[model samples]
Target: MNVESIRLINFRNYNSLNINLNKRINIFIGKNAQGKTNLLESIYMCATGRSFRTNRDKEIINFNKNEAYIGAMINIDNYEKFIEIKMERDKNKRIRVNKTELKNYKELYSGLNVVIFSPEDLKLVKGGPQERRSFLDMGISQIKPVYKYNINRYSKILFQRNNLLKSNKSKSEIFSLLDIFDVQMAKIGTDIIIERAKFIEGLSDICKNIHNITTLNNEDLTLEYISNVQLLKNKTNMEKEYLNKLKMNFSKDLEIGTTEIGPHRDDIIMYINNRDVKTYGSQGQQRTVVLSIKLSEVELIKKERGVYPVLLLDDVFSELDEERRKYLTRSFNEMQTIITATDVIDLEELQNVERSIFYIEEGKLII
Candidate 1:
């Protein structure tokens, strides 16, 4: 899959811009704060229906504008798709594919598959559990669009259950409400847990192999999914176990004013040589772990979707050593890759790749 072109209007600093993308490589070169990353953000939003940098839609709109528009033409398996997203300051965002309006953002997942690697991804290794969870959720949702619906359902049920726990209502009333929420939450949460477990297992295998090659077999990387519920191999049994755990934790949850256990509280742990990478690994090691995971994502998406997802690299080349940079550039030869960098970092590795370079300056592109 590849993006053929992208159009931006009032998005971040880009008041009005339109550009075609190269099938092999498209490089955006510029100084800091030159709308290099903002261009990538627009494409990502068209793919995943959310901004990677901020959750607020209004944040992506130019400060002086009340609305923003992003459109992209993508090719998947030789079929072209046009996706458009419109965001208003106080109104809900609208999404359309081939001129057909979608009821919600989740519907966009089925069309475009993108794997984005940015400096913020370092958070996948060094940041809190929420970061890892977001990584897992987003990655899975791409291959299985229904997974997003399940996650959304689980979140809503969890929210209501937490609100009930925090209420000043009588314990009897809360328990009655909890009874309804736990069953629903467990069913959806169980599906999410099973899906995540499968994805993590596959991702771990690929990442381990990639990390081994990248580090010359000196470091061993492994990924493990940690769930608040003791997950059984069978979904039916796992759902029962989840429901029981929710019931058992109700008293504790009531005391704390929050629902404490479920997929939302789960985490992904990266281990290097059996030690938690986040806790003990060096900065270089953590970076290697994130690199392995991202490359694994590209491979996994291809394995599941039968086509490589478009790769978006946002100013990450500067952080990598020449060896790592060469490794990344080499992969660009196989798929469409859009990269952003302050300046040319590895001209040697870039020599053989067919690429188009655009100098971005304050939201304008100079080819």
Candidate 2:
């Protein structure tokens, strides 16, 4: 899918802006804090109906304004689509597809895919377990929108169960209610774990090739899902295992006032040459691992959905060396890519390529 154009109003530093984006490589050149990342964030928000950088939608609104608006005309498989989102400080965000209002985020999230690579993604390899799990979950969600629904449902149920655990209910009352919560969690969390395991299997297969190329055939990357409960190969046994663990940890969960034996506590482990990258990999190795993972998402999405997801690079080029830059961009030939950089030198190799270049100064786009 390719974004044909985008319009922004009172979003971050942009007061009001509209610009047509190139189908193949749109580069935004600007200094730090000049709204480069904000531009990419807006596109991401339109595609996913949420922000990647901030949790609170109000934070995206302009300081002097009470609302923010973002709209985009996207081309998916040669068909055009219109997506719009409006956020207010005191109200729920409104989303519309092809000018029709949607009741929930799920209505707008399906079939709109995007993979983003930012400096922050370096955390995928070097950061905590949650970081890696988020990376895995999002990569899976882009292709299988249904996975996002299950994830949201699991999250909500988990919240309710945790709240119940924190309440002053008696042991018998808590146990009775916990039985219902555990049943629901086992079903949803099992789906999450199973889908995550399959996605990791696919991601590991693709990332191995990508990591090899990125490292000149010197590394073998591996990815695995690590859950608090043992993952039995049998589906029945898997759910039973999770349910058993939840029961085993119920008392501990009550003591801690949280639901702790499920997918929420799960993680994705990354390795290179049989060594845990999180603990043993150097800075360069970690970056390469992240790059491989991000690029592999593009291929995995294409294979699963039969289309390449749009790529968003937020000021990450400055961190990559020349060789890695070439390897990264080599796959950009046909995909829609939006890159943010501080200067032309940061994207010198692409300067001569057929592309669209825009300069941002104080939130305004100058072509």
Model 1 collision count: 0
Candidate 2 lDDT: 0.87
Q: TM-score of each candidate?
A: 0.98, 0.96
Give lDDT tens digits, candidate 1, residues 1-367: 8899999999999999999989999989999999999998988888899999998998999999999999999988888999999999999999999999999986676367889998888899889999989999999999998999898888888888888898999988999878889999989998999999999999988999999988989988998899988878878998899999988888899999998889889998889999999999998888878888999999999899888888999999888877778777778887899999998755687887789889999999875
**Which residue pairs in candidate 1 collide?**
none
Instruction: Give candidate 2 regions above 4 Å deviation.
Output: 345-352
Give the clashing residue pairs of candidate 2, or none: none
Residue 194's lDDT in candidate 1? 90
Give the alpha carbon lDDT tens digit for every residue of 1-367 in model 2. Answer: 8888999999999999999999889889998999999999998887788888888999999999999999899998888889999999999999998889999866566356899999898877777888877776777778777888898899999999999999999977998899888988998899888888888889889999989988988989998788887767887888888898899888899999998888888888889999999899998888889899889888999999898989999988778888899888887776889999998744455666668889999999875
Q: What is the lDDT of residue 160 in candidate 2?
A: 92
In candidate 2, position 158 carries an lDDT of: 91
Local lDDT at 248 for model 2: 88
